[model samples]
Target: MRSGVSRRTFLASAAAGAGALAGLLPRPLRAQDKTVKIGFLAPLTGPVAAWGKPGLDGCQIWAEWINAGGGINIGGEPHRVEFVAYDDEDDPAKARTGATQLIRENDVKFVMMLGGNSWPGVQPVAERTGMLFSTLLPSDLSPSTATLIAPAEVHPIYNVTAVDWLAANRPELKTAVICAQDDALGLPSVATYLAAFEAAGIEMLDEPLLFDPATTDFAPVVTRMLSKKPQIVCLDTCYSDYVHPICEQLFQQGFKGQILSCTLDFYDQVIAKTSAEFMEGTLFQFPDFDDPALNADFINFQKPNEFFAEYNRRHPGQWGAVSWEYASVMDLWKAAVEKAGSAEPDAVKAAMTEGGEGLHAFGKARWWGKDLFGIDNALVGNWPVVAIEGGKARIKEFRSIPDWYDKHGELMKKHMAAYNQMWDQRG
Candidate 1:
């Protein structure tokens, strides 16, 4: 990747530019005196808050940018964007209630979700109301859920790209062991990692060490995983809550090998807890937006470096995997609403998937996943394989998730079925 401007320099320039623009135009431009509400329903105050709260923070930034820029144009009119947020705490009952309130009371046109434990509760609401919903987890998609779409962040499936990169670059680290908190998020990820490892010709030292989500002490879990002496320790889609303690355990125990995970959210904290040298070369699927690679031509995010700088300035030490994901979904939704000339959920959904393709964060992607998800709802494309170099998360490469599936999809399906994670099995 080409070297980019420093964050401090970039932010300084951005601030100057904004100040210059403000003099030329009215602040908080409202072009048409209209407003559109979007719903952010997810776990914002529990163990999963890392994913939910940071994403909402990013959405606030997105809304400010859009509203200040004269809002989204639908046909010939501009509509200021507003987000209605609800904290589900990853609880099903709360999620159901929150979804209803967002749709019925708040009159939100679109709802975005983290989509794991809370998805079941919102699925029925979507079906009943015909309200379009977006999920980070395409694993939540099925034939019965016509209103739900996975427009961004195809989780677990994207985990395969990191393993693929590892197997090619770190071939010496062959044997691996995996572990995850046994939950909606962890089970599917465990299966995906198993499939990815198998396809890479890496032997799993043992079956995935599933643990209770309630378990706080990770010392024993890390000890059992390290007992086999595997070169790679895979932390399957564990929440940031679980990943932090487990990584600390790995560092304390002094196992020098490759570390892989679906996400290394708040990794700076991890490095601080351990050591910069200890976290070096660790691989995962999400990159810090300030990574120079995000400035590449094909990347669909808007001014990622600026966004990253602004996010840090406003909410320091809070950026995580989902920080930009919800904003990314809003980008797609805005484009679709403009294309369809309406903010109606069905119209926007149809327009978003009009050509069976979408502009994913990394690049252009296909509306795939019928064979696996029982619906062509997921926008699958290249996903970044991130590694910690010099104590900073950087994008190593963008690996094609669909390409890997084309070659080893059956193996993945087999593993998903074994874990009862396949769409049919889920129902």
Candidate 2:
């Protein structure tokens, strides 16, 4: 775009013959170009890195595609987008430090995070600076947090769709047990599942099991859960770390019941640990990109199958829960920036929520969740109910999240209140 001339060299040339060159060059070419810095603050290392790093990898591919297509056009000038990532290690202290550094040092206009455990660390910075940010978790949403939005995967809440689908399709499974590691991510999810199960008329075999994050052996947990002899097992949004061991335990303990989870990341490994037969009919929320349903008209992600293949190629055996989520947010942000004619945070934020409608990768979703999470920042639309049929992940159905919420909003609020998760109650 600089015509092979360095900025300094171009400035020198312009100064010497400004009028002649300016008259000949196109207006866009004559304007000074820029590389817009977008900060990526997530765990690229440490225990929860699988959930963080793969999304960053997908973002790299998104950046490449945008740049190759001549970058994002803002105010008639093409500006290349560059991502500056910080490894927060999924730690609160490190997340705060990373947020401060990205804001003060990198001067990024937007910051994307994996959210959940790390959200509290960056909350202050986001409030103080009014910096626009995107999170995967809508539980992180609150009225006071004006600049943050969840335009991609709406976690836990969408988990309701999976439960709803299972209840409709597999009505014979009447009793269930739910379990999660007791933390920000797990607690909200546990509450959501509790509400979903109640709405579907599924009886709880016991109170939802809570475990420490440092938990290693899941034999005891599985043993206790199986003692109840639940017709269904709900792994209520456990991290991929816990999902594996808990699933393996279920197999080893020889408990045969419907297994449900908020996610089944790298499920092939789970199948390997247990068996293809064992994983059959296992239900969860997230979908594999190669699924035929992704070709639907409402799906906005560009070349999802290609993206998934390339991600696997570059980071073998590493793709997990968040592999496509952060990149999906990038797509929304880029569109907002172009529409607003500036990359400034406030302008883009306004543009993104202009009509309370967003092009969520799944489809056109509305900015909902104010009544539930105290903010209408999460993009709510249809979500896929994924099932492992014959050891392959397949879309059982695409359920309308808003439709479900309309009927069961009260149930969700009740459970969220019971968990003391309603924004105003977080004291």
Candidate topping TM-score: 1
Candidate 1 ranges with C-alpha deviation above 4 Å: 1-32
Worst lDDT 10-window in candidate 2 = 9-18
* Maximum-lDDT candidate: 1
Error of 1 at 414 (Å): 0.3
| lDDT of each residue in 177-259, candidate 1, tens digit only | 99998888889898999899999999998889999977878899999999999999999887777788889999999889988
- Point out where model 2 deviates above 4 Å: 1-32
All predictions: root-mean-square deviation over Cα?
Answer: 5.7, 9.7
Candidate-wise lDDT, in order: 0.82, 0.80
- Tens digit of lDDT per residue, candidate 2, span 178-236? 99999888898998999899999999989999998778778999999999999999999
As a TM-score, model 2 comes out at 0.90
User: Clashing residue pairs, candidate 1?
Assistant: none
Q: What C-alpha lDDT, on a 0 to 100 scale, does residue 392 get in candidate 2? A: 82
